[model samples]
Target: MISSSRCTHLLLLLPLMFSFFVMGFVDLVGIASNYAKADYQLTDTTANFLPSLVFFGFLLFSVPTSILMNKIGRKRTLLLSLCVTMAALLLPVFNKSFAGMLAAFSLLGIGNTLMQTSVTPLLSTVVSDDELSSALTFGQFVKAIASFLAPLIAAWGVHYNVFGMNWRILFVAYMLIAVLAVMVLSATPFSDEKPADTSGLRSTFALMRRPMVCGCFIGILCHVGIDVGINATAPRIFQEYEGLSLTHAGRITSFYFICRTVGCLLGTFFLSRVSNRRFFVLSVVCIMCGLIGFAGFRSETALYLCVALIGLGNSNVFSITLTQALQSCPEYKNEVSGLMIMGLFGGTIFPLAMSMTSDGIGSQLGAVAVMLVAAAYLLFFAFKIQGKR
Candidate 1:
C-alpha cells in the first residue's frame, strides 16, 4: 500500500503541474491558430478551425483512453499519453506546413485529452477519501494557474522568436513538461487499484449500462458544454462587442478560471457538509444567470462579472458530477470515472457548435446566445440530482 507520507511529497504535485502544462498548451492552441493564420495567410473559416480540431480530440479520446487506463493500469496509461504528447509537441518542428501543423494540433489534442482523462482519475486514487474534494480542487486550482500563465508563456515565445522557424517553441515547453510528468510518475507511488474485469471489453460496456453511469455521463457532458461554451463565448463577446483588447479579454477569462478555483476551494471546504444535489442544482442556476447576463446586455463591467458568475456556476460541476457519478455506481468507480471524462467531449462539440453558429451569423455574441440555450437545458439535469447512498 502507498503510504500517506509518500503521497504527501511534492511529487504528488508533479502530476498536477504536468497536467496543468498539458492543459495550458491545449487551451492556448488558440494562440497557435491565430499565429498560423497570420503567418500562413489562411482564410477565416480555416483559421477559426484549428482549436475546434483540437477540441475534437477531447471528444474522441475521453472514453477509449479511460478504457485503456482501466485495462492497462493508470501508470502505464499515463506513460502512453505522455509519449503521444511528446510526439505531438514535436509536430511543428518537422511540419510547419499547414497540413502538418493541423495534424500536429490534432495529435496534441488526442494526446492531451487522454492525459486529462487519465490524470484526473489518477489523482482521485492517490488522495485520501476525506480529502478528495480538496485534492481535486487543488488540481483544478493548479490547472487554473496553468490556464493563467499560458498566454504569458506564448507571448514570450513569440516575443523572443523562440521557435525561430515556426511557433513550435511552445511545443518544446510542452515536451519539457511531459518529461517532468514522466519523472514524477516514476518517483511517486500511487494506488494501482483498478476496477475488476478491466481487461474484458464486455465488462467495460456492462459498467456503462448502469443508470447511475448514464446520469453522471450526461451530467458531465452537459456540464462541459456549460463550462466550455461560457469560456469560449465570453472572450468573443468582450473582444468583438465590448471592445476589449484580446489580452484584456483574457483577463476576464482568467476571472472565470479564478471563479472556478474559488468554487473548487469552496466545494472542498463544504463537501462533507453540503449535499451534492444542492450544490449541483444551485450551480446550474448560477451558470444560467451568468450566461443570461452576458446575453442580455453588452456592458463591459457587467460582462466580466457575468463571466466570473459563470465560472462560479461551473466551479464545482466537475467535482460534484464526478462524485455523483461514482456514488451512483461505486462498484465501478474507474469505469464510471472514464465514462464521466468522455462526457468532457461536450467541450469539443458545444464550443464548435457555438463558433460555427457565430460565424454563420457574422456575430460573436450570437455564439454566446447559443450557449445560453445550452445552460438552460442543463438546469433540467441539475434538478434531477439525488445524492446516492
Candidate 2:
C-alpha cells in the first residue's frame, strides 16, 4: 500500500503531468506549417520559417525565464506560460491570415520556452533525485501523447471539417485544453525551492565552462535539431520520394510520433534500470542507422522503418541529456534548465538549414544529410556520459 504522503505526491503530480500535455501543443507547428504551406502556397523556406519562429523564443527567453522562475516561483511561471499559450491558440481562431498564424505561433514559442524551462525543475520539487530521470521521461511520454495527437487532430479537422475551421480547428481544440490546464494547475499546490543566490546571467552562462555541462548542452542542441528536423521533414520526405498526397504523407508525421510515444513510454521504465551511457549510445546508434537508411532508400516500407527507428531513438534524448545537465549543478537547477531548454533554439536552426539545403539540392535528401550531422554529434556525446544510472 502506498503511504498517504506518497499518494499526495502522486495527486499533485497529475496537474504537472497535464501541463506536459500542454507542452506538446508547440509541436503542432509541424503539421500546421505543412497545411499553411498549402493554404498560402508558401515556398519551402517561408513555410519552414513557421516552425523556426516557434523555436526562436527558446534562444531569447530561456535564460530570462529561468530568472523569472527565481522570482515568481516555478508554478506561477508555468501559469504565465499557459496564459501566453492560451492567447497563442486563441489567435488562429479569430484571424486566419498568414501574418496572424505567424504571430500566433511566435507567442506559442515564447509560451513553450517558459513551460519547458519550468516544468522539469518543478517536477524535481516533487520527486526524489533517484526518480528524476524516470519521472522526466514519464513526463516526456505524456508530452509525446500530445505530440502524437496534433497531426491526427489536424488531419481529422481537415477531413471532417470540424466546425468548418479545417486545420485551424486544432488551435481551437488545444486552446480549450490550455484553458483547462491553467485552471487545474492554478488550483493545485506545490512547493518550489528557494531562489539560488546567484541565478544571474553570468552564473548561468558560466556553467558552460564545465565540460560535462557543455557537452550535454551541445547534445541537447543536436537532439532537438534532429527531433524538429524529422517532425518537419518526414511528411515532405514521404511526399517527395513516394509521391504521396499531403494527406497520406502527413500520416508519416503521426507514425513518427506514434513510435516516439511508444519509445518515451518504454524509456520511462528502461531508463530507471539501464546504464544511462549505454542507453544513450544505443539510441544514437539507432538514429544513425535510420539516417543511413533514409539517405539510401526510396522505398515506402524502408522509409517508414527509418522514421520509426529515428523516432524511437530520439524520444529519450531530451530527458537523458537534460537529466545530466540538471544533476550536474543540483543547486542551480533553474539556471541549468534554462540553458538546456535554450538549446531548443536548435529547432529553429536545423529546420532552416534543412529547408535551404533541400531547396538548393532539389531533394529531401539534403534535409536528411543535415540530420545525419546532428546524429553524429549525439553519437560522440554518448560516450561523454559519466554514470551507470
Question: Number of the top candidate by TM-score?
Answer: 2
Of candidate 2, the 10-residue stretch with the lowest lDDT total is: 191-200
Give lDDT: candidate 2, residue 258: 91
* Residue-wise C-alpha lDDT for candidate 1, range 1-389, written one tens digit per residue: 86877758456667655665556556556556656766788744566577667767876676677678877788777777777877887877777788888888788778777777777677767666666666766666666665545555555666577747434576777678777877766776667777665534456567678776776677777777766565555665787776765545545555676677787777777666777777777788888877778667777878777777788778777777677676667666666666676677776666677777877889876666777776666677666667531
The whole-model C-alpha lDDT of candidate 1 against the native structure comes to: 0.69
lDDT of 2: 0.91
Cα RMSD (angstroms) for every candidate in the order listed:
3.4, 1.1
Q: Which residue ranges in model 1 land beyond 4 Å of their true spot? A: 1-24, 34-48, 158-169, 199-203, 206-208, 244-248, 387-389
TM-score of each: 0.85, 0.98
For the record, the alpha-carbon RMSD of candidate 2 to the native fold, in angstroms, is: 1.1
Q: So what's the TM-score on candidate 1?
A: 0.85
- Residue 141 deviation, candidate 2, in Å? 0.2
